[model samples]
Target: MGQRIFRRVSLGIMMCVLATGLVFAGSPLPNPPHKGEGILTVNIQGVFNAKVSLSPFKGLKTVEPIATVADVRGNKSAKIKIPAQYFPGEFLLRLDYRAKEADAPYPAERIIYINQQNIEITVNPPYINNDEKTKFNSGEKENTVFSAFMKENNAKRMPLDLLRQFLLSYDQPKSKLYTEGVKEFEQRRVEYNTWLANQAKIHSKLYVSRLFQFQYIPAIIWSGDAKERVNQILKNYFEGINFSDPLIIRSRELSRFMDGYMGLYGMQATTVALRDSLFTQAGSVACEKASKGDPQVYGWMVDYFYTGYESYDIKPGITMLQKHINNPDCFTSKKQQITQRLESMARLVPGALAPDFTMNDNIGKSFKFYQWKPQARNKLILFWTTTCSDCLKLVGELSEWYKQPANKKKLDIVAINLDEPEVKIGKWKAVIANLSSWKHLHAEEGVNSPIAREYAILSMPVMFLIGSKNNVIVSTPGTIEQLVKDLK
Candidate 1:
């Protein structure tokens, strides 16, 4: 019985030890931890005591100033607590603190922005002497001058230097200095263009032509003497090149560039002529070369011509395009679209007679091209405008066409001007005064002209062929060859 009692006592002791181990394992030991979020300790070491109050911005629930204190300590320092939630986006942290009576100014105001992080701003008193103020102003002026010189030099080293200068100067705070800088920059562009022109002439190279192709042509067009000089130089250069010579290929390529450049200059008719001439030459060369089995050269020639034709006129462009389409290795999906656009436009071809339409003239007098002359042969009515670059570009082509036997014997050409002011009509007349083979009419009523609206004239320099019966034949703009073919 004594041994059994001893075993019971041993079991009881084991249970007590097991319970103590479980309790120790379940509960963690105590550790010395960090206090409230973080503390902002402000140390004021100045001759004057400061009054400090910190207030949190609105919409922030957790952040608030713990307290306000007066006489914060002329020799001692203080601390303030800042909550973590106040640190993001844009918030105004206002500090209204006052200095001692003898200090420069009491309650110096500071506005701080809490943006993605905390900011520490330390306040210090300004110098109390006049000599320091004078030195500060003088140094500021020197720094300003140095900064301006650096900006100007840096801008000059960049592309579009003049534009950069203008933008930089314009963005400066409004002042006489900024305004003068802007005027100077404006004048600099004129000087630069003048220098560019002289260099172009001296090099006997088509600098403006090259510039027009690569850079912005509209700016050159709007520019003064550069436009006229560039146009004259291009014309002269074009006259010098022999179109039939193989060596003249580079010069012929210039014509493609001129096609686009002329459009920008409002020489629509001339642009078209240049484009057509280049493509015709290129296409003929490619076709001839392909026949000789020079597929590589032929392909290159085909691509060059195709690009020129695409930008100029997509309809008549199809004549040369058919050869490319027939070649299995040369045609692409884009070329397929060209074929489709041509077919769609072909439905408006000549011999169908012109569509009947009433259009008001510039003077508000309504007229009809179909009714102009009932007994006239097939009439070639060109719908164009004084402002149209493509229309002006077409004049050279028209002049060439007028010399052709088929066109001379079978058709009469008429030009319709769609310029706004009545005075602009006279201007248009003067512009094309040299072309005596065509009649000119102006629609001063602008886009409101009934004729332009009826045909859905979204693009300018459109041409129409009207048959002898005054029926619309082709509404699509055609080249001289296409027009002659239709006439035949």
Candidate 2:
């Protein structure tokens, strides 16, 4: 009876080994069963003294794992059978087990992919130098594990695998990991862009035949900054190419994509430039073709152009938007918004009558631009501050001019200190102390003074000369020297 039992166990072990080898060999080929087709099977082997379980896949309900255990030569192995209907993408294969001895643990985890082609991944637990409890909590160790998994699996999968790893890394909640992943993704994007550019250049005509090239351009544009590097890349690729070129003609799709991308980011200049360039190249044919079927593209162009006009006073940009926004509803809404914003900007246009505003001087005396009368040939309301280097430089030049005999009687320089806090105004006072002939006033009310905002003061060292009628004679002259020249 012992002989009979021994023979039976030997036969079972042989059968299991044969089944495991066959399954492993067939896995990588594209022959996994689909619905109403052959059922896909997974047989796990080489596990010793551990419990194993398979989780139910959430995506495909019809797919289930069949669990079985067998004892061979005092060691145990687990087998799982997976059904068809699971998608071709990556799926997690989880294992759970505890070792009977404290020193010995299950040596490996396996990854299984089921589709027309079956893929298996074998993972070994990394060696931990410190205590097991500490190892579990080590972020560095966890990163190592993840990196190993990506490196091992990356060979089997192509670009998609790298993309998947990037997505996984980005999903990590920790900022450090997410930042690292983003950096890697950016590097990959740069490499891909370079590769695509090379391919297009080599097989210029052949590449344009594929419609996908159009889709690729917008992504390349989005990943990089609109700096010199990107500009050079685009110029090199598109220079000397006319609208008749197949790639140039096909680039209309890319232009549409850019319109949507820029609109989402609210980049007024880039959106307007791209749409205008496309319109010039494709003319009415492009618009009419897009209107007939690609409403999304048309709508993106329309919205981008309309918003561009509202954000800037570029006349050409406004004209482009006017041509595209012919639809009554869109035109009306966009027209109203643009008109309102334009009117607001028009009030700040240079060479116009400077707005009247009141501000308190350092001595608590209120001074109004329209009301103050200077005691020189011309009153120059030279807007400046102590903190501005350019303003200081201009003041040094003006001081030289004051020392000259010709300009002393002709120009009156009234300094307006826009700096805050009475203490911070010392720098301006100290600089002006030597030249007591010129008048200086500090706007004690800080930046909130109505005068500052009315003049649209953004930077320092601005100058506005008020004529006898209190009208602004010169607004934002090129430089101090230029202002003096203009006065002469």
Candidate 3:
């Protein structure tokens, strides 16, 4: 009986010790053990009828909400369940609330990083960044570490950036002051990069470390003309990037980085033709670099360039995308869209037969896009919408141009309106009343309609000039002036 009593007491002691260890492991301290199933709890005050939304970054500046909680009154708390996929990445929280009883809701957003831990934050929507007004859980590590790093990083980077700028623009390169400035700038840059590298190593296990990689600035040669200096920057652009890590795609920094790189090319372009050539060359070089690193990143680079090229109607750049298109290893999410763009490039060239399609006009009369019969000297097929400001601008310009008797006799236009969401249809109807000179048709499915897919109409204000004799495309004119020139 004494032995049995000892065993029972020992088992109870073991259980108690285990519980204590678990509590201590998750205690309120820096770098506490990660616990919970990726839950975000928001406690907001100073507002009513509050709606909180949690979103994950899919691309630079593009976020889609994963969870939402609505009708949270002032001084109340609400929980948002973050799915497993979104964890281990950065997130954005948006609060929509009303300060007064009748006032319209105001929106405010805060950025936070989540790494499989329960985060509870108290915020006043209007003053979310004020330390006194808002607070996060003391035990949270991901955001805390990131915030501290950025604070120091900005402080370190300011002087270096300013010094470098001064050195680049300083007229007297041989002056003692300029030489001293260059030396100082180089010393500081080396120190900053060293600190950045150390910080990344210290936080190697944290996701925020991946972000630190972008802060690694490459060395630039201050001695040279503008183009030569830009070339030096391009040569070392990927010095600090770890392209093999797919997480770079989840950060907006990547987009900004690419934008800066592309802007370098833009600076050297003096004409439209030169700009197109430089942009395509930039795309080729950048995409090839990424292709050697990660397949997803390679696909992202290809998609980015393709989007830009399509928007600018850069046929050579569009053609350059063909090399990256057929690679099986590329995991670009925009595969279908890319394929459609390539199809448009191949089939929409001059002298090529236009795809034929029969659709009812707004008046229920059937219209054929292409046929053997002749109606006029040339036909213009315009894809547009009332919602798009650019499309509206183009249509307004074209309408005024078409008012001339000679233009009306030479060109017949078929305007395909891609307005939708039912309300836009009402607006389209109202707008087209004054635009009756041109035959109008509405595609109910917007850009996803079969006709749009055939033409690969990804964006607005696309036009095709076709000869009425055999429905062969004469040219894809970007502007009204170009259309007039093509007709001549």
The candidate maximizing TM-score is 3
Model 2 scores worst on lDDT over the 10 consecutive residues at 18-27
lDDT (10s digit) by residue, model 2, range 1-488: 00110011221121111100000001122222345332222222233344443333321221344443322211333345445433332233444333333434443333333333333222222321212211222222222333344353344235533553454434453577656655665676556445444443543322122222332322223233334323333233322122222222112333433333333223223564564543333323333333443344454445444444322323344454454555542323355444433453456444677677666655567777677666555667777777767777777888887888777667677677787777887776677788677767777654455565665444456677656455565544636766777677
Worst 10 residues of 3 by lDDT: 16-25
Off by over 4 Å in 2: 1-137, 140-345, 348-352, 357-360, 363-368, 421-423, 469-472
Over 1-488, each residue of candidate 3 has an lDDT whose tens digit, in order, gives: 00110011221121111100000011112222244346899998887757999988755654778878977888899899876666577788899988876989899988888875788999989998776777889888778889889899989887876776677667899899998997887788779878887887777767677777667656657677656766776666665576666666776767666766776677667888998898888888888878887798888888777767766777898788777877886777667777788778887899898999999999998887765344578888999988777788888999999889878888888899888877888889888898888889899899999899888898878999888888889999988888888888
Which prediction has more favorable TM-score, 1 or 3? Answer: 3
Model 1 whole-model lDDT (C-alpha atoms): 0.44
Worst 10 residues of 1 by lDDT: 17-26
Please report, in order, the local distance difference test score of every candidate based on alpha carbons: 0.44, 0.43, 0.76
Model 1 C-alpha lDDT per residue in residues 245-357, reported as the tens digit of each score: 22112222333333333332333224656645544554554345443433333444454445545445544454766767667655233454456545545545545434576
Candidate 3 — what's its lDDT?
Answer: 0.76
TM-score per candidate, in order? 0.31, 0.35, 0.88
| Candidate 1: regions farther than 4 A off | 1-353, 358-367, 374-376, 403-406
Model 2, position 147, has a per-residue lDDT of: 39
User: How large is the C-alpha RMSD of every model relative to the true structure?
Assistant: 32.5, 24.0, 14.3
**Rank ordering of all candidates by TM-score, starting from the highest:** 3, 2, 1
